[model samples]
Target: MNSRRDLLKTVGAGMLLKLIPVGAFAADLVKFVDVRLWPADEYTRVTLEHAGAIKYKHFLIENPWRMVIDLLDMRLDTTLKDLTSRLQADDPFVQQIRVAQYDANTVRLVFDLKTEVKPEIFTIEPIAEYKNRFVVDFYPKYPNDPLLALLQKEDPMLREDEISRALRLAEAETNGTLKLESGSAGSAPNTEVAKTEPNAPVNSKPKFEVRRMITVAIDPGHGGEDPGAIGKGGTYEKNVVLAISKRLKTEIDKMPGMRAMLTRNGDFFVPLNTRVKKARSVNADLFVSVHADAFIRPTAGGSSVYVLSERGATSTAAKWIANKENASDLIGGVNIKGTDAQLAKVLLDLSTTAQINDSLKLGDAVLGNLGKVNRLHKPRVEQAGFAVLRAPDIPSILIETAFISNPAEEKQLTNAAHQQKLAEAIAKGIANYFAKNPPVARTPLT
Candidate 1:
């Protein structure tokens, strides 16, 4: 009798489970909310956003060059398949993408590559409005040199000469035949070389002044997954700041003996330290980060310039702005495990007093010129601990073009004519600073 009772209980539990709706089980499966692909010359990033945690494994395959990623315990869905449609014909890295259900609970993604690539795949926890994200970045096996790219863009005709000179200087320095000396803490380093002739004098003064192209690193803040501050009219801070930065670059490039290099020339996110590294790599004369400000209060309107402050932010507003800007990396999704610890330490520890002073001078010049185009947020430049401005050697400043939160300023920021005017004012300010300070000889990158 007991054996019969046990059998009846087992049958009853089985029946109960069968009666449950299939839709109830399906709802528990992870659902991909959205997918985004950002392609640029530097790298390509793929983001998969889902409502719940996901386990993934990715590997690289050769002989045709493909990347395979397996999503464990996730069902294949239409949103996951949409990744193939996002690939652009002119994408620098990827040629095609294929998605399939490899098993009952695993969705596989295969990325066909145009060339050899180094891939970094990771996951990010939910933040702000973003859900759990699985991110993949494809970088070239051999990355292009930022300095070479800058020179080529400035003048292709002069690229060969510049490269040859840089190579020769590098060789001489390595052989202990050349030494570079700076007149002061903030001045450019002067190149001093030993005589080329055998048994010649050990020290020889430069015969003439060496004037190289002046490089200014123009950074357009907030991009890709990070939309920055959104205005009431739906203007994205990333888009407007990019337009303004590009215009500023055009204006700067037109100046005599001056050239500009944009940290990013497209819609992509760059880590803050990467921006500083690019400026230092190019031996930039000045680092200008362009941004559109936002405030909780719509009444806040006007332009402001900011330099790095060691003590603390000059005001509460400055501190708030810095905190917001600094959060960009978190929103943009940096692979924390892949970050270079040494590089980060250098960026954080190397802010010098001299750099700050020079930054202040540049800020003052830019602030004065900005007042001509729009109302000044403050009569003087504000100071804060901006991560992008922590290049130990280069003078850096952040410019808040206008408060994008304000309706009037948002409309003006979207206007092309106004953008051009802002560009002109900024260019004039840079010109003024250069005229008064006179950049010294450039130091060659090692």
Candidate 2:
């Protein structure tokens, strides 16, 4: 009787299990909407932007130095497949990307690396036009020294004695300390060889005599993923500003005893803080950030120059403009998690009274010159708390070449000839400022 009861109980349990569906046990799926890759000299970044939240894990593989990323509860989708088309042959780190279904409910990604890399992985919550972003950055274990980069290029600052001699010569020209014949621009002094453009004039009258080369850092605002303000005619702010900045660089390059370095020479995203650090690294005598502005009202248009305000912005519009410019890092997708908070804080708090004073003079000179070529938004130099201009020791100014949102101004900005004119105006302004206010002799950086 006991054996019969036990066998009946086992039969009933088996019958009940067969009634359940197999699909009920499957995991929930996560869809991938987009993937982007940004390969820069600083590091290589791979971003997976998806519709829904994702659960993922990554690990390093040896011998070949591959990075494996596994997404849980996800299947291979077309969006993920498109990642292959985005790979560039010139990528500094990643050789290629491979995707496969690692198991029943997980999709895996393998990154073939060109060399050993220190990888940083983090996730950013959805912001602006972006969805949830899973970011992977391959940074070299040993980052390159910024000073080394400066040294690799031509040094842009003068020694103490050089500055003193230049000052004495300048004072002599103005204070009647000495009377030297004013030579046409492009004409070299007896001491040095001059490289002049075929159509350009040489340094006709160099009132300031610097013993060492004077370096200026020209920064073109917004690039790479950051398109900046878009014009109605389809001109991108990044491209326009870059063109203008490059023209300005060429003009500055031709000046005797003065050299110029660009913050970026290509279409790539550079962090705002990095831009500041770059100016400092090269020991720039002056920093000029070139940009094209946009406004909510299409009728609102004109060029403006801004210097850092120690307290508050000069006007409400100035504050709004500053806030908008500061948003580039967010739109361009900075790896905020990897940023140095302390360093960033220091940069933000670094604006000194002397820096602002010098910046105002520079802004006035540029603003005055800009009016000659383009309509001035404000008659006087505007003051705002612009992050790119916060290099405490460097005299910096931000110039808005024109309002790209305005139909008329957009046309002006897009014209190559107009761009050259703007560049020349700015170069002239810089030359004027340096002529009167010679840079003080700074100790060489260790």
Candidate 3:
């Protein structure tokens, strides 16, 4: 009887062990699922995707410059080890990465640096097509001024000529002798430097105009982690828009008295507020954001233009596009703790009526030109509350190059020749706007 009772007890213990969840023991250690690194002149971002929430602590060390991160309750597995191989030769921040098991329950990652950096580390909750993420951004200790960098790109001789002409105009305008008249088509408004008196000496020291260089901020929408939209043929909206923006920049640069600055020159995520801030920092005269539209129905095709609307969107479709574009921050994985709250509040609170009026004029110009390149999505420009277009002082417009969701349009968007045509048309429109409404003097020509 005792032997039979012992056998029954043993059988019950085995069944109980079998019934316990197999993952119970493993749940304590979070597993890394993927890793990515994006390197650019502005900053370098390191992202670690994992199965669940993770606890981590990081520190920076100087002398040779290094960053160290320790992940608690994690295992150094293949996914984590793969981080060592992701470093690129041209990375501006990190020289290399080393991963190891610091302790039985901790994984340590060390980043050897190429230079001193200001690092921001944060986490993001899971969103569409992404799991929990740990992100680290390495920024330069002393950031380069975008405006200064832009000025350095111009030819010294040409810059001097511009300054001299602007100074002459300024002096003449001050003397109340300057007469401005509209220029020929596709040209800047002609400045007529008339004498205060008909008998004024021709050789008298010419007072220069106070006109400063016109700066246009060209923003390529949805980059880095935010692919904007994906087509059935796997075309990424980010790539298509970036290509077009670059082409547009080249075209703009060729115009006299004008220069262009790109919000992002590479494949990296920039916050919407940051994009606005960059434009403001450069004292941009106009802001043009380039993007490729996408829709649920693959049949949706055509180009569209949008400007900021203080009251509401122009139509249901406009509202939908605005909402989708606003959600870019979530998918792009902004570090909530590191965001500029004050800047964000200012962008959202400021009255933009004057800005909107100018933006509509600019949008109309661009939309008219876009119709020449492709079918128009809307015969006129639409209005929406795009966060990227909320710069209260600057006239901003968002251009949907075409519907990338349509197979036919996707093919055109990817073609280099079509992209150039789009760039030329947009550039012509900008020239037209400038001809009609000349840029007012902001700073004295230096």
The CA lDDT at 34 in model 2 is: 87
lDDT (Cα, tens digit) per residue for candidate 3, span 399-426? 9999999999999999999999999988
Candidates 1 and 2: which is better by TM-score?
1
- How high is the lDDT of residue 206 in model 2? 42
Q: Which candidate is the best by TM-score?
A: 1
Q: Mind giving the per-residue lDDT tens digits that candidate 1 earns over 80-180?
A: 89989999999999999999999987999999999999999989999999999999999999999887777566556665765667656645544556665
Error of 2 at 175 (Å): 31
TM-score of each: 0.88, 0.78, 0.84
Q: What's the ranking of the predictions by lDDT, best on top? A: 1, 3, 2
Q: Which stretches of candidate 2 lie over 4 Å from their true place?
A: 1-30, 155-211, 443-446
Per-residue lDDT for 440 in model 2?
Answer: 61
lDDT of 2 by residue, 298-406 (tens): 9988789998988899999899889988998887777777676776788666538988899899999998888898889999999888888888888899998999999
lDDT of residue 68 for candidate 1 = 94
Q: What C-alpha lDDT do the candidate models reach, one value each?
A: 0.86, 0.81, 0.86
Query: Clash number for every model?
Result: 0, 11, 11
Error of 2 at 112 (Å): 1.2
